[model samples]
Target chain A: MNNNETTAASKASKPTHEHTHDHEHSHLDETELRVRALKSLLSEKGYLDPEALNVLIDTYQHQVGPQNGARVVARAWTDSTFKQWLLEDASAAIASLGFTGRQGEHMVVVENTSDVHNMVVCTLCSCYPWPVLGLPPSWYKSAPYRARAVSDPVGVLAEFGITLPTGKSISVWDSTAEVRYLVLPEQPANTEHLSEQQLGELVTRNSMIGTGLPDPASAVSQ
Target chain B: MTNNSAKSNLTATADVLRELPDIPRRDNEPVFDEPWQAEVFALSLSLHEQGVFTWTEWAHTLSSTIKEAQRDGDPDLGNTYYLHWLSALEQLIIDKNLGDAAQLNKLHKAWDTAARNTAHGLPITLP
Candidate 1:
């Protein structure tokens, strides 16, 4: 092999630690280490090889990520009975729409009644219900989210551009072994007669995550 | 998946496991009728295998629990946390012991298949 080719090959064959030495003393936390190891395994196994990376990227773009959280939104908007059922047992209720556990399986749907509003957090670890929702976004699992969601949930929601009314009591649900929760937000005003599909289109993932209210106009714009 | 590739991956993983710190044994443990602890132990290993966490991280986490327990005057090592995770999985696999094992094996095989397919520029679909 030529000198350049030899150098490239040598680089390719080098141990991971040798290349990672710069970050060795960086006090890599458990989460970081886990992410690194996962990436390393993926890369080494060619699951993250260059050509595979492209396909993976495409898959991520086309196949993965959140589907429209519209049905839940629509039910809240029009069908009061369906909304009640959703609040009672979200997993079974959502399954009716064929959206039962795609990613987040362990789910408990909480209602935002006139007196109380509900929010969710996986404080101990990111034990999300992936059966309904897809894999959690990076932000959901971040340390800031885990810490802040419990201590100052209102403030965190504010940061996400969501604000509750003064009289509304926000109840933060800590997802544990028995259940994972989704926030069944109140129906937004306007578009009362909109079709189920249209209402479903309006239910953004953010609303389900208790970060935002549904916006039919926004869905229409999209 | 090629046998060589699968073998190499297993070797790499085993090498990592070999480097892992020993899990300290506990004494006068709660004598449960079920093999709950073993199941939790297996789940932690499975999670580690699935790349949810690394050996070093798990080791450190367990170590911290041990340290905290020692400080709190609780003599028991923090193996219970892992034991709990395993028990959860075990309970999940109840009445389907063979099925659970098969599922684990399937996951391993899928990982290998994905790895091979990824090498060939094909997307690996996770089961």
Candidate 2:
């Protein structure tokens, strides 16, 4: 082989760490190591299709996520009729808005009023509203969150740096496989003029999960 | 504006996500913290398609694994979420008689060798 072809051929044949330490060795976490191992095993066994894996990852990583839910929250906040419909029959209202699928088939949008605050958790497992909220965060799926959200909603909120009113009664919704819950955080005081899209900018992932409030419209408006 | 924003979320989502200092995000989107998390997640779904285990079976295994970890004094901090997921997958593989413990271990070792010998950012390939 000529000089260029020989170089290219060797590089192609020996694409390994032993080639040269041109860059720092990247460390893979323990779970990551195991996952890679398992993935390879499955692929070798003809069970894991790389194309199918990419499709699933792309769906959650890009196409579906909390952004879908945020838009729903913003619309509910701005449109009174939509809000009413959402409260009355959330699944239909949300699906009407085009955010409907697995883990969101039976949605329950709980309102957070001055006298009451709502928090959601899955005491049994991470049964979150995936269509709107996407996958549950690590914190949402944790044992502490699942265990304490029901018994002490306020305390759980405090841990998240959210302190509700001492007099306000907190309601902890334990989401199930049959139904999912989303928190419609009270529209902040000075957000009447914001457009639905602008208001949706205020809605955050945690707000829909009841662990946080929407970003104040004033912040975005300013 | 509503129609436009719904169709395009990266910009607006990024703005608000920046304000929440405590939450982990990439490109202003809430996503798996590591590649492994995503792989394991999709692995479960892919395996289901392979009929390795039903969704109900997978969920039950995962839930029970979490419960067992909790009973064993696992703090269940954010980190362990996917570890339980991996455990569930392993359990299902063995339970379904797809592979025994020894075979799985051998596969794991092969990957480890490939990983050790592979260059950073290069695909891990087994001979």
Candidate 3:
């Protein structure tokens, strides 16, 4: 077709798509209004309070997250008996460390083996092992992580810069009723001669969650 | 002298109030007054809002659960209370309608916003 003819044809098609797009925009606005109304109803029945809500939000941000997980990882590295106990019964074992029974009650610990590795996701929601590990990271609670982690764990982990060896199948545990999991990462190599405190330094929060293993070099540098 | 120290003292008092703990009440007596309790309370309330359980049920469950924990020799009040609170929240979230797959999508988005940039706290953007 000639250039003008082609241009005329494209112009005719553009309006249809634009009309659909505008329709979708308004549809989304209406949906948002419904959701807001529902949420407001939930809030009004004494179900939600702004002050309490702020406190919950603040606790997750300031008190939980990497810092809390680090404590669990450090303890696991320094104490062999505790590591065994943690793998066996995470809740009771964590209680032994004076960090028991919080947001993640139905606690289970997954041990990383040479042939198989494990990661956790709460596909239904952001169910986490909060007592031992503290609040989950934003990514952990994300749908992309929750949905993809089960079906394509290696792929998801790779996005987090974690690459598993060939022939190693990744087992993704879905946190549901009566069972929540924490990952017991493999201890770092060449740290046999290090003191317990030094070993503890090698353990990072990511290691405990099985996303990434600890780097001895960074630990020593810090 | 010239009222500067007085002003400094007032500022210090405000700081103290900000740092004040939310204690668990026993016959209106403050028992587990600690910063952590506030965290537990907030989590519990969030779960309740999500409809995990009614407040009455939560109160009953928590009281019994705490007693059991104490019996088991885990007497750390703040931690134990939080443990119960967490359980209640989890159950509540699980129990809610959660409605369709679209609702799940909305929750995922909400969680992402809440969890990220969380250096501050839970965002006001939660639906």
Candidate 4:
């Protein structure tokens, strides 16, 4: 074998740490260790197809994330008819916009009014609608979040930088195996002149998750 | 026709997934809480799609891994389901001659070092 081929084979076969002595003090979290171990082994064997992986990741990150849900929210915010339809039948309304499949086959849209604020959680497991929301954030799946959301919705919201009105009653929805929820946050006061697209830009994943409120002032009008 | 069929499709998929462990798949949507969890899930699916392993084999291995964990005092809480999944994937890959333990252990250590040096929220680029 040629020198280059020898080097390549050895590089693939050898442990990377043996070549270096700099990591004397570092430690890995158990989950991180397992994930890396599998990923590396898969790559070494050519089983880790980067392109396929990217396609899956990009699909969630771009094509089927909060942005899709943002469009739904924006449409509902600007058009009363659409809003009514969404409230009445969210699955059909969302699917009509070409956002349907998998975790999003069933959906429920709950509106936040002046009197009642809505929050969502999955006490048993994180059951979120992936079609519109992509994936649930790590915090949503945490033990503290699952337990505390039911016991203290207001306090949990406060930790997420949300402070609802003192009089507004908080209604927490525990997402389960049968139903998924999407919160329709109240539109901010100054966004009346903004177009539907512009309004959609103002809606964030957290706001839709009911852990945050939209920052309309930051959504530059075009 | 499409709308009615779409609703039926939901029932179809939901019914099948209802039997899967760790997933409350009746009427509930699947929620992947972490990026790594999604990545691992996609890896398994892609592997299956490529005909590397049959669905039956994948399900059997995964269920056994979870069962083993339960035997070892794992609480069977929903959170650790994916951890067991990763374990099963590793074992299956090794058994199938797709990879070896020595290489995986090396990579694991390398990743630990690299991750330690990287700042929070930034992606870990293995060296």
Q: How is the predicted docking of candidate 4 categorized under the CAPRI scheme?
A: incorrect
Q: Supply DockQ values for each candidate.
A: 0.03, 0.19, 0.03, 0.14
In candidate 3, position A96 carries an lDDT of 71
Q: Looking at candidate 1, what is the lDDT of residue B94? A: 28
lDDT of 2 by residue, B1-127 (tens): 0000011122234454334324222234357877777888888878877777666677678889999998998877756788888898988888987667777778777766667777666776767
Model 4, A1-222: lDDT tens per residue?
Answer: 356544644665565744333232244687878887787777776788978987876777557778888999999999999999999999999899998854223688889999877788766555677778877765665556665566656556766777776677777776754567899999998789988989998898888878888876676544
What tens digits encode model 2's per-residue C-alpha lDDT throughout A1-222? 246544654676567754445332334556666776777667667787888889989998888888899999888888899999999999999999887764223788889899878888778778788889888877787666776666555555766778776677777787765668889999987888888888888888888888888888444555
For model 3, the superposed segments whose C-alpha errors exceed 4 Å read: A1-58, A195-197, B1-127
Candidate closer to the true structure by DockQ (higher is better), 2 or 4: 2
Candidate 4 residue lDDT tens string, B61-112: 7767866876798656557767877888888888787878887888888888
Q: Which candidate is the best by lDDT?
A: 2
Best by TM-score: 2
* CA lDDT of each prediction against the hidden true structure: 0.51, 0.74, 0.55, 0.72
Sliding window of 10 residues with minimal summed lDDT for model 2 chain A? A18-27
Off by over 4 Å in 1: A1-65, A102-106, A219-222, B1-127
The stretch of ten residues in a row with the least summed lDDT in candidate 1 chain A is A23-32
Interface C-alpha RMSD per candidate, 1 decimal:
21.2, 10.9, 23.0, 11.8
List TM-score (chain A only) for every prediction. Answer: 0.66, 0.78, 0.69, 0.75
Task: Give every collision pair in model 3.
Answer: A101-B83, B52-B92
- Across A68-118, the per-residue lDDT of candidate 1 in tens digits comes to 345565665578788777777777777786765423335567777777766
